[model samples]
Target: MSQFKVAAVQAAPSFLDVAAGITRAVAFIEEAAQKGAKLVVFPETWLPGYPNHIWLGPVAWQMQFVGRYFENSIEAGDVHDKAIAKAARDNSIQVSLGLSERAGGSLYIAQWHYDETGELIKRRRKLKPTHVERTVFGEGDGSDLVVKDTAIGRIGQLSCWEHLQPLSKYAMYAQDEQIHCAAWPNLKLYEGGAYALGHQVNNAASMLYAVEGGCFVIAACALVSKEQQDILCEGDPQKEALCPVGGGYTRIYAPDGQSIGADLADTEEGLVMADIDLSMIAYAKAAADPAGHYSRPDVTRLMLNSKPQRPVMAFDETAGLAMEAAEGAAAEADVVEIASAAE
Candidate 1:
């Protein structure tokens, strides 16, 4: 088993400020690097901030501000790619961070990885955005849900609530993901009521599930404050329904379901570090590997096949035989119409 130190960064992201978020992330990565961490992971959608407001129940008819909120999100391109890559290269460490990915015209909950040299390694879009998130981000295909081979082992990622999906977890387990990156925003108070206990319980359950699957899980969570919430939900008090202040449960778990690292205060920006040995994976799997042993493969198997769908347009074709025929017919019709008019 190869030994490596991993860090789970728990921080607060500035709302709608991509540059500032990147800067803060870079600082966290540098701090982790100084602490001898080879790889660092950040919470979900830390870039451009998580739009927690959408989850705050139904919007009032008068409050059309929800749509305007998404307009401030960031896109993935040279600006973000270069900045993030440079951070990884400068620190000489692998980095996995979540952000809102603007693809074509739609947004996706995306996680991106960078190698030690600051090169883009892999990008995984969230399989499904939870509840109101569907209103803002698009669903991702299986193609983007993957584990990539890296120097640190087979690293994989799942954003927020995707960890709750059984099939999604199985997909990563089947790929033999040794290091699983789980990103999440801080759970907040719901407008109809106070903080939901279900959010924290689900988070813990997901962490334990990762360990049960024989993987080292780095769970990162955002730290939202009352001031931040106030800024995000200024005009309409209903926006308060989205996310309340102060619920940071960032943690790291081992393959044996042990809490290896966590933040005690859950208020400030910090990181939880743990030493992970890849050799433990073999030991854990020997007990029970869902995809390997203790399975009834003869009964059923899951197979995924995907095809690309391309958009069609009338003018896009091999030559223009149809166009020529149409032109000739139009000329005949014009002549007939002119003759009829003369008569």
Candidate 2:
């Protein structure tokens, strides 16, 4: 928990291409590490890319790319995962990566942490997908809502709109998260009508989270390139208006809600590095520590289930054999009773 430099990336993924994304991400990691970054974070669903089509047109229209999306979505311990980890290890830096995780037939927005040595440490998914996101991604269990104690600090993350979830944010803060990665899709609106969902408001939400939780916030936002928009909005005439390009605004905020470094341009693609002093967290917490002196356990408390939920639980061969033996014993006893009665 000492002073260290952290990097946040605002870059475009190789839309629907996991392998290309891995290569691009590795290059970015190397670039950031060269700049003396101890830790680096990427935007939500940086692998392949965020489902921008979901927000552009109807659900039926978005279905066209689902196949390619699924094919490119990465699985934990897959080749792409190993490559990203190796990148971190090679650079000698800790990494927090965001990607579309494919588990079975469903996809989940996930983040994986790699230690400075390139060892996989913790993996977490988005507790809930927002609005159109639900169309493509599945919900994460309580276990996904967590923080890990890393060489950098107590690092935790939440994807996109999860930053608005009061309970979710409190859950991480309660874990004493020292560095929070706020992973977000590109913050482009159809017409900038809902400014809250736009870059400015989303950035504000990240800064507020940092101040409230007394943690350094790495606001990693994805970039939506013109090419990506054209592809996602091909059939629709409202393409330009609905899916405008260049909405990457990655920034780093201190515990006091102050920007740690120069904010990246909304249209920029690169890493924003900031040297964060963990000691500053003490100063912010001194005024109002949400999980410490400021909380009221007597009145209200947050409860986390943290259980890995699944549709089915499998049993081993030993358990199956045990059940079979008991059934056979019962059948034999019934036969013996019948034979004795007949006698």
Q: List lDDT for all candidates, in order.
A: 0.75, 0.85
Off by over 4 Å in 2: 235-237, 316-343
Model 1: weakest 10-residue lDDT segment is: 334-343
RMSD of 1: 12.8
The ten-residue window of minimal lDDT in model 2 covers: 334-343
- Per-residue CA lDDT of model 2 for 1-343, tens digit only, reads 5987899999877899888888899999999899999999999999989988787777787789999999999988888888988999999999899999999999999999899898988888898899888889898887787889887789888988899999888878877889998898888866466777788788899999999999999999998887787788774667768777888889899999999777777888888889999998889988988777887666666666665666785667879878768756754543311011112
- In order of appearance, the predictions have TM-scores of 0.83, 0.90
Among the numbered candidates, top TM-score falls to 2
Q: In lDDT terms, how accurate is model 1? A: 0.75
For lDDT, the strongest prediction is 2
